[model samples]
Target: MTTFQKVNRYKKIIQDYINKHPEKNSDDVLKHLLLRHIPLNKDSEQSLQALSKFRTTINPFFRELVKTLKNPEKNIIEVLDIYLKANPIKKNDDFFALLVAYFNSFEDLYTNKDLQNNTALYQQVIVPLHLYRERMEKDKVDLACELLERRPVLKYEDRDLNAINFMSPDYRRISSEYYENQRIKDSVRKDHRLACEMIRTMAIPKKELGRVITDLLKKIDSDDSLVYLIFETLGSLPIPKDQQSIVVTKLLEKVQNSKNRSDSEAAVKALIKIPIPKQQGEQVAGILLENIYSGTYDFRSLVPKLASIEGQLERVVTHAIETASKSKPSSRIFDNSPEYTTHRLACESLKILAGLPILTESLRERAVDVFLILAGYSDQQMYRPALEAFREMTIPESRHEKVVNKLLENVDSKDGIYCSYSCQALAVPTVFEGYHEKIINKLMEKIRDPNGKNIIYFCVALASMPLLEHQHDEVSNRLFELVDTKNSDDFGYTVQQAFRALLKMADSNEEYEKVAAKILEKLDSGDYRVKCSVCNVLRGAVLPERFHVRVVTKLLELIDGKDYTVMNNVCETLGKFPIPTSLVEQVVSKLLPCVDITSGHHSIDKCACEALGNISIPEHQHEVVFNKLYDRIDTFKGSFPQSVKPDACEAIGKINFNALQCPVIFYKLFMRVMNPDNVFETLNRDNMILNTLSALYNKMTPTERINIVARLESMQDDVASKQPNRLPFLLSVIQKCQSINAFSAGLLSHLPAEKAEDVRSGMVR
Candidate 1:
């Protein structure tokens, strides 16, 4: 027979089977055809080709199959089992899309056992599902909406069924009128109401949302629970502009007059969320100002909202200055005194006011006046916030003279702590530039005094101040002299700060080498404690690249030292330095043995792992380095603690493996991290690996990234069931598959509503 005739015959046979079993969908019919008809026809290839040619005839069947998967009459696992048996039918993109849609239909709230008892079926589908992740990611919104319309809640077992929640006073009335009529109880109606609300909110169209917003607002005066839920719902929806005022009015009433503090807090929170018009920003600011001293609103939340408008911010600062003026400065703070309360409030208010981006000259002067008054009060706790505020002020160069005078006077305070705090505040470059000489002269005078105190703060403040090329030598020579005066226990910190001060002066390659040589000289001549302090300084330093080898060479010698604190400090400091090409062998050789389980030092081992990660290993060294690190991962050896494994995984992941090596490295990481026996450890280790993979992802070639993603996708089940909290992190890494943010926005915009709500809560929680 001709090929056309044969194709026609096969179509007829499949049609007869579908006609006979009217209940069977495309997947079922395909299975029947494969199991029963293909053998009788004895032309598997011909039948398969005919099916592909007449695929359009079966297009409706595929759509019907997706619908069935959405609200399956039978167990979804059993349903998919039949689908998986028909491998030929699974070849098309539609089947893969249907699989992804079906999987996402289940909520993250479902327990692993509730999801799929049939591991075989899940494994079969996950492979192809992952293969089509890119395609589904593009259509994620449409797919979620489609699935929601048919089967709003996907995984609902009898275990989830519970009596209607009558805990809320409104529950019985609402359930009797709404849920009772709909008969949603056989499903997880009571238990998953939030899930229902989330899906309902997501599925609602923009045009329809106005009415929902209005209805939710009308009920804001109900019980506090319902009021919070309504306000939360309002925050998520884009309320109409006309209704925005209604929202603000309702929330304002709650803020000023709600019986419960939580309700007032919630109202203030909701007000912060709704965008106020630029023209009306001052009006909102005025309303908030009216309630500022009412002891009802959270000023911290109100600050950002008011700060959005320049006029509002100025008004806020003006009000803050007025409030500060009400409290008289006293010799000491008292808990019960009204003056103390007012002063405390003023101090807190000034700190918040100081953080604003813009402060008018008059407001700055008044605010500084309040700060100076607060400084004289004997409360040490109150001084730093006020002084820090003084430091943070955005004073133009023309206006800094008075501020410089006040700070300098404080620097000369006989109260040592107060002097140190003032010195700490002078570290701002903008304020310190022209006034460095006056401050330097005062600090030098204090340092030279026999009774001087807080020398460490003086050294730190001097180091942090931006210095010109001509000032470097003078400061370095003074710090070096201080380092030479360090035999006494009281001068140890002074000596360390001196070393830090000298290193901070090195901005040029020659200067850096000079500093490095001086540090080595100290390391060689200094005691164990001095060596430890030097290592600590280098750990936080920006690190000098030109003289990295000399520093690295010195650090390597200290790595194997008997002092635990010094060894760990040395390893951490070494991690901060990029390995110079000439010393890669020397550095790696010295550090590798430190990570060995036999090293007997836990902290040092972890730091060694970090040090290994910080360097760039050549391609030729990838195997030895990867193998050594991989052996430290838990799955390879039981003795390695969870603490060490994550760092080891991090160490291995940071290496730039060749394409041929990417899959192997990822596979090892996946196996090590997917341990179902211990979910907590799995999550922590997975987080470490995924973070490293994400950082390494962009550096890899397109082909290498694709391979890595495919390998990661293959373990989707292990991720979904084993360590689900890490799902967001995994998706984030996978999202790098698409470069543009618009595509990411779509993914977020479609994230199973409740998931999106959780993400929002996580931000503030």
Candidate 2:
């Protein structure tokens, strides 16, 4: 008979026996047919394929069929080759069972000699053999060793090694075999797989590893891949103290001499991980500083490493300041010169100094003085960095007066940029509190000048200062007068700054009421930027109880505006209010429609979805709000903008779902994740849903979590049958639920002894 006809005939016979012996399961019936009519030699590529149509029946028969074979090892290889060729996804239980039977029948499959050089068979059986080694009675460690000796490189070494480790207690043997394979291959050509595996192994001796690195560095110029892999291996593994100088010298040579910028950067990254010898620290810092001067590397990456070297922080800082002082400004209007590079390096250096872990008291004072001097430089770029570094430092309380006097002097400078940054600097802690009167009076003088440059920054500095009750009205009114009401576009930024200042000074409901009145007056000024800014302030500010009603009403009024920006900001503001019971319906009713796909604007829809997350939805309004978000997930049809679904998931988790509603909410979020079309299975989207699931699971009663887990388990079969690709997502949800319950019930510490090490490693990873 033809292969197709013969397969069909076998299928007919199996089905007939199954029908006759309905009392017996399919596995039992398949076993009966295999021993009685279908001989062991009857197996074929087409026959296996036809029998595979009967799930779970082939596994039992494979177990029994292997026992009857004369040359089981050879026959099993044939079966595996045909089966693997047919089903490459390789998740079938029957295929796994066949592998188990194959290993059980052989004392050493590699001992067959015919199979040792069978690369195809070796490649296919390597992963499965390691995986099922625990089930076999024979010690397969030797077989695994032989397999690795022949096939030492794998693309997926992390998974492959993890499987190999399961077979043998001495992983050092497996690791060393792979390392030696790479060493031998390195003479002919570089094998990155072997190199990467060596980096992961903890068994390679320090002297041997150093020799490998030294050899690789000799050929670093000829092969670019060796440069990256060798450095990565060095960075990941700790260098022996005796070999540190040898490696550091070579890397420094690369950093100083190599023309390739990426090579230099990689060398610097590896150097950062190595513990610099105390004697070489200064030399390392000096080389890095030279690169920093040329602007060849990011100073942020280099400076911290420079500071980390013993006693080199001050040298780096001083060099930066001295270099900056010598750079003269270009007389040309648009100049790109070494002068600009020097000034930028200086500014970054100042910021980096403040960020260093240990700045001695003397060095701190010097840093403060140098920053003040650079603040007065004609270069406008130095202003913010100067103040930014000044802000980050904790000026000794004793020096607060001296620092404030210097800053106040700059506040009066004719350089508007310098004066504004000085004002910003004055808002720092002890200085702001100790000298508020002087600082505010100086700023008040600047704000009164209507045409003053950088007035918005001055206003921002003023807003950041806390106000006394007596000074609130005068300072706020002065800022408000600076707003150009008739044509806000001319002063839109300044207007936003003024409104923000008023919002900051509002410490009470009465204070916020005044700010609200100013906001109400500008809401119709035809400038959406102003409207958006005011809404943003309310969105971020903690609205007092007295202002909630008035603000919620105004926000609700703006919710229907045609401008999406205004509507987006308005929805975001309304979300922050603790909507009174009387206004919950109005707020929910307005927001529900905006979260729909028909809204035509993603920003508005996204904001509306997020707004639903924060609203105090009365029990009566939960169903409607949920239904709107439910329609927004696009579980089967990715019709909504991808941005809207995660927000919807967040909003669903935030809802106060009743007993009947929790499961419904979880099912939607879980299944939405399972359906790939929802956000295309983006990691970000999956994480958002996973976080929402975890949070929601935590909120449930222990009993509710149990019921939810049970319900989730019941859907696994449907997921396997219909959407098998998403089995991981389903499994993740179940594991996450169980993990949350374990932690909440204080059972994490009580896990069985065998799993303790695995759990700790998982947590560390």
- Which candidate gets the maximum lDDT versus the true structure? 2
Give all TM-scores, in the order shown: 0.60, 0.57
Model 1, which residues run further than 4 Å from truth? Answer: 1-302, 309-311, 322-349, 396-399, 427-429, 432-441, 455-475, 487-492, 504-514, 540-546, 593-606, 620-653, 663-675, 678-690, 703-736, 739-765
What C-alpha lDDT do the candidate models reach, one value each? Answer: 0.60, 0.63
Q: For candidate 2, list the clashing residue pairs, or say none.
A: none
lDDT of candidate 1 over 122-181, digit per residue (tens): 565554444443333434334322322332242223221145566878565665555444
Clashes of each: 0, 0
In TM-score terms, which candidate is top?
1
| Model 2 spans with C-alpha error above 4 angstroms | 1-346, 355-357, 396-406, 409-419, 432-437, 447-473, 487-490, 506-512, 597-602, 618-646, 656-678, 684-686, 701-765
Taking every candidate in turn, the Cα RMSD to the unseen true structure, in Å, is 14.1, 16.5
